[model samples]
Target chain A: SAVISQKPSRDICQRGTSLTIQCQVDSQVTMMFWYRQQPGQSLTLIATANQGSEATYESGFVIDKFPISRPNLTFSTLTVSNMSPEDSSIYLCSVGGSRYEQYFGPGTRLTVT
Target chain B: GQQVMQIPQYQHVQEGEDFTTYCNSSTTLSNIQWYKQRPGGHPVFLIQLVKSGEVKKQKRLTFQFGEAKKNSSLHITATQTTDVGTYFCAGEDTGGFKTIFGAGTRLFVKA
Candidate 1:
């Protein structure tokens, strides 16, 4: 199991601004991902953070809106660019387990107004 | 696109009562996993079912995978206040790493 931590537990951001969330894992992992969850909704995969390369984003999500950077196997950052009210949600960092089960971080709650 | 459908989006039960959540996938799955998320908390991995018709138990929690590998369920016997949370099931397609997550079922327990 991997221990993951995210920064800025909760933040209230103004619209049109941007916020960068950080994720750090205790152990090296092959797969790291970013997810979004609206209030009382299911999780939606945002992107896969690939170390030393561009992130693989899911459909409906783009790099211009959510740019991700993974410097190493255990660290990654996600930037929510040009935030809007619709961007208000919980951003989670996760690492894949040996059997594909995912371990999640505490998540960074962003409230864009 | 793959989808995992969950039933009874919300359930309210009294303490000591039983609770159950079910998930069905449109495609065959190689494995299914369950997770629990408390209010204002992140999702925590609970268990994973790999083989068809698999049944696993952890204390008061019981998980079952359908023979078709396209469905699963999680049942809690004598539910407690601690069981109050959202339960989500994720299904991974055969030979694919991409997982489809269910909408989740929120269990509310009254003490």
Candidate 2:
């Protein structure tokens, strides 16, 4: 099991402002992903943070809105740009292990005001 | 686009009773994973089923993968207060490009 940690467990920010969430894993992982989970809803994939290349985003998300940076295998960041009330959600960092199971960070709860 | 549908959005069960959640995917999956998220917590990996028609057990929990690899189920025997949480089923497409997460079934256990 990997120990995953995310910065700013919870935060409140003004609309139009951006918030960058950081995720650190205890060990190196091949797959790192960012997810957005709305209140009382399921997890939605934001993007796949590749180690050295551009993140692969999902259908409803784009790099402009959620810029991701994966500097190395054990660390990554997700920045929510130009946030709005609708963007308020819990952002989570996940790492996939050799078994294909995922380990998740505690998640950053962002509330756009 | 692929979609994974989960049923029983919410369930209320008495302690010591049984509970189950089902998931079906629009596309065939290479594997299915189960996760549990306690209230105000992150989802924790519970188990994964890779083979078709696979059944795996962990303590009081039983998980099943459909023979077609397009659906799955999780059953808990004698639910306890500790079992109260949202259970999610995630399916990985055959291409392994992405994973589709189900809507999740929130379990409420009354003591």
Candidate 3:
């Protein structure tokens, strides 16, 4: 398993504003992903943050709304653009550690008012 | 996309009693991993099952993978108060590192 640290454990933002969350892994990893979990709901994949390239957005998710950046193997960022009340949720970052093992960060709780 | 379905959305059990949660997938999986998330905390890895009909134990908890590799279960014997939280099952498909997480079963252990 890998140790991941996410910044701004939580934040309160106004609607129409933007917030950027950062994820840093203790060690180098091959793949890093971003996921969203609404209150009392299951986790949903937002995008795959790839190093030195554009992120891969999942179906029903767009890059314009959630821009992701992976500058290196151990760091990545996800920016929620034009926040809305519906966008208020827990944002999580996960990294593929070893054979089929995924490790997650503590998560960032975002509240859009 | 693969889907992992978890059953008994919520479970309430008395301490020292037993509890179980089941996970079924639409497609066969190469491996399935279990995670436990305490209230207000992130999901933590518990164990991973790789072979068909495989059973692994961690103290009072037992995990099993179906013979078809499309289902799995987690059984806790003598449940404790510390067991209160959500249990999730994540599956890793063959030849893919992408993991699909189940909705999870919330467990409530009462004294």
Question: Which pairs clash (backbone N, Cα, C closer than 3 Å) in model 1?
Answer: none
- Ranking of models by DockQ: 2, 1, 3
How do the predictions measure up, each by TM-score?
0.98, 0.98, 0.97
True-vs-predicted CA distance for residue B40, candidate 3, Å = 0.2
lDDT of 1 by residue, A13-107 (tens): 99999999999999999899999999999999999999988999999999999999998999999999999999999999999999969999999
Task: Name the lDDT value of residue A30 in candidate 1.
Answer: 88
* Residue-level lDDT tens digits of model 2 in A1-113: 99999998999999999999999999999999999999999999999999989999988899999999999999999999999999999999999988779999999999999
lDDT of 3 at A109: 100
Better of 1 and 3 by TM-score: 1
Model 1 C-alpha lDDT per residue in residues B1-111, reported as the tens digit of each score: 789999889999999999999999999999999999999999999999999999999999999999999999999999999998999999999966787789999999999
**How much lDDT does each candidate structure score?**
0.95, 0.96, 0.92
- Model 2: how large is the Cα RMSD against the reference? 0.7
In candidate 1 the C-alpha lDDT for residue A38 amounts to 94
> What's the true lDDT of residue B9 in model 2?
100
DockQ of predicted candidate 2: 0.91
The 10 consecutive residues of candidate 3 chain A with the worst lDDT sum are A95-104
True-vs-predicted CA distance for residue A43, candidate 2, Å: 0.4
Candidates in order, interface RMSD in Å:
0.5, 0.4, 1.0
When just chain B is superposed on the true chain B, each candidate scores a TM-score of 0.98, 0.98, 0.97
